[model samples]
Structure formats: structure tokens, C-alpha cells
Target: MVKDVFTNVVANLVTALIFGVSAYIILYIRMSGITQTIRRVIHPKQRVFALHDLKINGINRLEVSKFLSPLSEHERDILVKFHAARNGSNPHNGSSIRLDGISPVSNDKKEYTAHISKVGFFDFIATNLTAYPANAPIRSFRSQMATLMRSFRTFGLIQQVVNEVHKYGEPKKVEDVLENRSLANIISVSVLIVDATGRIGIVERTNKVAVSSGNFGATCAGTVGDVDFDADNPFESCGLREIKEELNLDLERLHFDGIVVPKQKMQPIFLYHASIDQTWEELFPIMEQARDISFETQAFYAVPVEDIIKFASHTRMTDTAAYQVWQYAVKNGQDNNWYKTLLLPFDVKRYLIPWNSQKDGTK
Candidate 1:
């Protein structure tokens, strides 16, 4: 009897081990492949899954001219109509500024910086999406996972890999969001929020959060999205995403890359310029619908650029990067008084990083 019991126990243990290992392997593959990740996103019981569209391109392929070439006449017409209907004005025709060439590491000596290869930013997801198609988020998804998959975001594979390496270590698994081997470290967009008054929108970060919390900074900011990755003006789409997520407000017109600055070990800040044409009292009700995705904001304030400089003079109340952009826009707007309202037909030449010298002054 004792012998028989020992054999049965061994068999059960082996069966359990096989099942556990096989489950992990399947989960691993599903996480890495875009098509395979559907299982995690479809169920109602699952945690919220953000679908990120990582518009990863190698450094060599990111030619400013190619990305900024004039839109086809039809696309241009569509964009014009789209902006007119939504933004109430036509954006300036001009060159675009990009910080794509900036290095993420502060002291790394490499002349060029691209995504870390191990995580797979270079690998392409076989998605059928083309640059900016006129479509909205897929809301038909009945499940949380479906919602995430349709949310339309792209994450850098390199950052995703470094952040998830530890999850693959042991067989014992607790499912963390990053452990999926898909989600990556984040990049962000900072919009110099403003209104018709030409006032810069600022927010006080909650003291409890990480990084620049409690500091006065751009309240309108977030990661770049999937559609904007390959569009004629992708930066503005990202600006819209941050606005929708934080304030639930989607202003029609936006100017991309009002400023681009790379900080130490940080992705260059893409400061897209957008001015909302509304009063603070009118804005309060609109802001109430906001999801406040990051929970980082304490309050909102709209102050004129000159006032901000004066406030900073005494107390350093400005997000320094955003401050520089205010100066840039003011100067670029010049005698036309366009900067005061952040009107369209924005001057792209003024905003480019000093290294990228593109001379097609008007888009």
C-alpha cells in the first residue's frame, strides 16, 4: 500500500509541473504578438489593459523632410476641412520641428540614439492601419480588454523589454501589467495649454505623486498615440490625447512642436501648442467630465506669458521648458499678434532643434 501511494504522489506532482509550465509559455507568446494579445483584452473580469500603439522607427529612417513633406492635395483638403470644422481655423502651412534625433541618455557618447533593440521597437506589428485615417476609438467592445485594444496607443518595445525582464525569471508568476512582455516604459507629450486669451494653462501637481508633483507645470500632457505616429501632423494628435485624458476637453485646433527639449535620460519633450477658446467659468463644467487619467493635478490656472515670467522671477512657478516655448511663440507670432491666440499657420522654423535646419518656412 505504501509503495502504491508513493507512485501516485509522484505522478500528480509531475502533472502539476507540466500544466504550470505550459500555461506560462502560452501566456508569454500571446503577450508579445499584437494579434495574440486579444485573450487578455476581451474578458470583462480582467484588469484594465491599455492598448498602446508603438510607432517605432529606426533613427536612420526618421528623415524630417520625408515626414514633413506637404500632404497630398486631397489629404490637405481633408485636413483643412477637418480643422475648420473642429478647430475653427486653418493651421499655418509650414515646416515641422521634431526631437526624434535627440538622445535619451544624458551622457551616452553615441552620436545617434534609437530604441533599445532587445525589447523589439524595430519589430513591426502587422496592423492594417495607415497614417491618420479619419476614425474614432472603437467603442463597440463589450469587455474591458476590447476597450483597451481599441484605445489606440503604441509603446516603444525597447522600454517595454527593460521594464519587463524580471517577470520572465522564475516559474512562480503573479501577473503584473508589465509582465506581459508587451507594455513598455512610457514617453510623454507636454502641451502648452492655453486659451483664446493667449494665456498659458498651468497646473499644480499633487504633492503625493512622483517626479515633478507639487510643482507648477503643464497640466495638458501625456504619451503619444497610435494614429498620430505616422500622420502629417502626429504631434497634435498626441496633444489631443493628453487633453482628452486629462481635461476631457478636445479643442479643434493645435500646433505641434511649439518646443522640443531633451532632458537627462528623458525622451525629448514634444511641446505641442494648443489654445482653447473658452472662459474659465465655461471651462469648469467641461473639465468635470475629465477622467484625470494620471491623478497628478491639484488645480488649474491660466496666466498670461508675461505674468508667468514675473511669477517665476520671485518663486520659480513655471515649468522651465514650457516657459521657453511661451517666449518662442510670442516672438514667432511677432507683429501679427497670432501668438497671443496661438492661431494656425504656425511658424515651424522657429521651433526646430538647432541641429535640424529645414528651410521650407511655410507648410
Candidate 2:
């Protein structure tokens, strides 16, 4: 009888393993689209907090173009102001998150001045180390499982649930905050590359980007992340870091033509500017030198800004954030000069604009 019991146990173990493997195959085979599609589901855009909900971090030299360390005080604030949340992937939306939950907190990046919650971040700005292969998803199921080990052990979550989280490009440490969605804040950047000759730099993304495979977008745009910098400037860190990773340029070596601050009247709030030192003639060579291999870019074009406007209507070049930069640059002026528009009424206190400490101290 004992022998029969042991035999049954062994059989059950084998069956479970097989079932797990089969489920993994079905899920991963769909590739990165599944995760990005689900992200859209959770982070629907229209649900934006009212203008009052807008928390603006002031802009500084980092927004326009500076690569040196000891980034200006305003630049550091960009990355430092926002809280970091592990970008996890879970299908369920509208998860109930209470503000007055277990208030257990000490100090995290010093942004915990007001609201505090028991949960942590479940969203992420993927690091360059999480690079993809040319045009493939960042990783396959086996790889994500390896990283999820920490969470399984720490959070006491089972393989089935943790596996979903990892597969969705989220870190497992988020398991602690999985039940708390209110703490999540997603930060991303849209880079617009303009050369001296009035040509804008854009790329056709490969399947590696997950959601916008084959879409045309700003030169080397990406999102902000905790690893990008310990400093406070999110926009500067996000843009500069992405440039280093995707374009392979040494920030110290970059030549800045001038700062181009997008005016609120005509441009999206997210658009920030810094003209690269390289001229139009050298833009292609610079692009060819890109070091990040985890991505797949079909082509980099140095077409006239006007031509890009013509292509703007085409679905291929429709990354709104990036496109707005073109509108701001071309319409505001030709190129090669620092420009700033008077701060608009709506953007007075909520949006980050290049500010003068002595002049615009009203806020």
C-alpha cells in the first residue's frame, strides 16, 4: 500500500509539470504584443486625472540638452520627484486601491511627504539591460521565470500568478504592492531629433519594441525609470539615458546647438528639446553607430522637416508625442537658436517650463 501511494505522488508531480509547460507555451507564443496590449487596457489614456490632479515638476537645463554629470539642480529634480513602481503585468483592471490602507512607511526617495500606502510600484521603465534581440520581445518565458524567483520566495505568491506578472514585463518585487494600484505612476519620454539642416530624425521600430512594432517614432525615445538616475530630473535623465543606450552617443561628447523649449500654445506638454552637435551630413553615421542591439529599427531618415509633416498624416509616423516636437520646431522657427514661448495660462503652475528663478518666481 505504501508503494502504491508513492507511485501516485510521483505521477501527480509529472502531470503538474507537464500542465505548466503547456500553459507557458500557449502564452509566450503570442509574443510581446500580449503584454503591451494589456498595458493599454490598464493605463487607458482618457482616465487622466483632472488638471488639478496634475503635479508639475519645474523644467531646467536638463530638458533642453546637457550631458555632463553634476546635472543642474533643476535637471536632477526631473528623475527624483516621481516615485518608482515595478511595472508588473496583470490582466485585471479597476483593482480596488484604498488610500488610507496600512500606513507603514519610513522613507523612499523623499517623495512620501503626503499620501502613503502599504503597496509599492507595479509599473516600470524597462532598463537597457533588459534589452531585446533586434526585433524580438525582450525575453522568452524561461528567462522571465528566472527573474521571478525572488518574488516567489519573498512574496509567497505561487508560480501561476508570479509567472503572469513576469511575463507581462513587470518585476516580482511588485508582489508586495500587487493589491495596491493607487501607487502606480507610469513615466515615459518622446525624443525628437532635429539636425542643423532642418531635417528631423525618426525611426521605424522593429518587433522588439512590443507594442508599436514597425511604427515610426522619435530618434531614440523611451520611458523614465528608477535605474536611469538617482537624481531628480526625470525628463533629462529619461532623454539623455535613452540617447546613450539607443543612439550610442557619449553625452559628454554631444555638441549642443541650443535649447528649444516647446511652446504650450502649439506643442504637447511632454515635448522637451536639445539640439545635437552633429550636423545633418553626419546624422546617418551617428545612427549607424547605435550600440543597443536588443532593438530592431527598420530605417533612420534625415528627411526635411516639411517632408516629415507630409508623412505625418501617414499612420507609420504617428507617434503623437514625437510628432509634436516636429510641429514645435518647424513652426516656431527654422533651427539653430534657443527659443522659449511665454508660459501659457493653463501651464502656469501645472506643467514644467523653462523658468527663470528671479522672473517667474510667482509659482
Candidate 3:
């Protein structure tokens, strides 16, 4: 009787083991199929923020949020004002942020002020280092500047001095070292304007004052501004804002070719391409309405899709991703890649552009 009972127990254990193995095999096969199916869903554009290399640090090492230590007092104030305006507060009215020293009250009271090195102030400029390839068009602009200006040559000398200082200066302030680090963590946005006529608006912008200025390969591109952007309408907001800023077009009637976020930190360049029915003469007056218009040196050119890549390549200031996006559009014909395919749904909110439009259609 004891032998019979023991045999029954062993048989039951064997059956359970076989069932568990079969279930696992079925589940694995289903998961593998699901992954491939997701990949097959292609997207038309890439998400720029998804690819950013954001490194979390011990609170002390957070560099992106630090106050602009390198800028002058006036410049710092301007940034603070910009931040305040974007955040719906008065710049002057805000409490003063004191750095370096702290005020000590009696044991009953404690005051806290944000420091210059803290990662939550104004004056931070985001930059993407990888997009600018050596000997690329951007370098050509630098080369031209080097040749044309005596001041740029002096900058080269200053770089040497900075290197020497780095070799000699002992570690003093951890904040100082962080300030000197030039890792650019900027966000890039592109808008493509397509008119009813299929003619796109392209600008030959030599204006360096524009945020992207000398580094970008394309025109009509800028970083996401200080304004709070909603994820639901990011494409419309960024697209329309760029159109109005760069081309002076009212986007109420325009159709946006959804936002394309890049894969690499700066892999997909922004090409806010718009199609407009208006010619240069008709659209010329709108240029004056721009918030920070830089007409110092700009010439309008309307080139077809076939020639845009070449023009952007020659411009030397266009975003590299712009060329790639245009190329993809041309090669793959519209059904290529979009943000949803390249990115997991959770990441979509961060990179999305908020949509905003004027109800009156006036300035």
C-alpha cells in the first residue's frame, strides 16, 4: 500500500511539469510574434526627444538646469525674464535666487534660495553635438567665419588658453567644472509646410541671430521654446508656431504633416516644410511681423523636392536630419516611418509638440 501511494505521487508531479513546459512554449511563441508585428507598423517621422542621451546624476551633477554662469548679468536677467514670461510669472516680482551664500536665521526660521549651479534656472541653451559632422556644411560656415573675421581667430587662441587652464587649475569648485562642460542638451523641432499647390516654402537664411543660426543646416527650425507645451497638440503648436515665425503664414488653413521625432540625439533634423500659394512678393510683408526677425542676410528660394537636399547640403547651416527626412520622403514615397513605430507609446508625450491656433486670424 505504501509503494502504490508513492508511485501515484510521482506520476502527478510528472504531469504537472509537462503542462508547465507546454504553456511556456506557447506563451513565448505568442510574444515573439507580437514583437515582430509591432515593428512592422511603420511611421512617417521620428521622435527627437526619444533619442536624447539623458544621464541622471547625483543632484549635484545635473548640468542642464544650472543658471547661466557664463552669461553676463544683463544676459542672465533676460533669460530669467524669458523664463518668467513663459511660466506666467513676473520676472522682477519673483523671489531673488541667491547663490554662493546662504542666509541663516534664528533656530526658528530657515530660508532657502536656489543656487546658480542648481538645475532649475533660466539661461540654459540646448545643443546637439552629434549632428554637426566634421567637414560637413556646418564646418564650412565655421571655416568661412574663421577666414572672414579676426575675432574668430582670436577665439581659437582662447580655446588654447582654456585647455592650458584645465591642465593647471586644481579642482576648486565642482560647480565651476560643470559650468565649463559644453555638453549640449537642446531640443530640436522642424515644421514642414505644404501648400495646396504642392510648392514648399524654403528660405536661404544666413541669419546667425536665429537660435539655430550658424549650426543648423535648414531654415525655419528652432528649439522648443520656454512655453509649456501640451502633449495632445504638440505637432500643431510647434508646426504652426514655426510657420508663423519663419514664414509668417497663418496655419489655420494649413495641414501639418505630423511631427517627426528623430531617433538619435540629433539624428532626424527638423524640416518644417510648408506649401504656400503666395509668392515672394505677396509673402514679403509678413516677414516684418516676426517676433525676432533677423533680415540681416536672407534670400527666399522655392526649390522642388528633388533639389532641396542639395540646397540644404550647400547651405551648411541646415539640420542634417532635415536632409534625411526629405530623402526618406522622396525615396519611400510617404508611407515610411512615423513616431508611433519608432517609439514606445509612453515616450510619445515628452517629444510631442503642442497645438495652438489663432481664433481671429490676426496678428
Give the top-scoring candidate (lDDT): 1
RMSD of 1: 19.5
Q: What is the lDDT of every predicted structure here? A: 0.40, 0.38, 0.37
TM-score between candidate 3 and the true structure: 0.40
> Least lDDT summed over 10 consecutive residues: which range in candidate 3?
50-59
* TM-scores for all predictions: 0.40, 0.41, 0.40
Model 3 RMSD in Å is 22.2
In the range 180-294, model 2's lDDT, one tens digit per residue, is 2312323345667666766666666764453345666666665454454344554456677778778776553222111211111111123444566676455445644666623
- Compose the digit string of candidate 3's lDDT tens values, residues 1-363: 999999999999999999977765554443223322332232212212221211111112223343323334464454444323222233222111112212223343232221222222232321112121111121233433332343233344334333533442433332232233322223335655433444344544443432333333333555543341332333235556765766566756333332223332322222344456665445556755676444422444444444444333333333334444455356535433333223433221221111111223442
- TM-score winner, 2 or 3: 2
Candidate 1 wrong stretches, greater than 4 Å: 1-186, 225-234, 262-265, 315-322, 325-363
* Cα lDDT, model 2, residue 339: 15
Ordered by TM-score, highest first, the candidates read 2, 3, 1
Tell me how candidate 3 scores on lDDT.
0.37
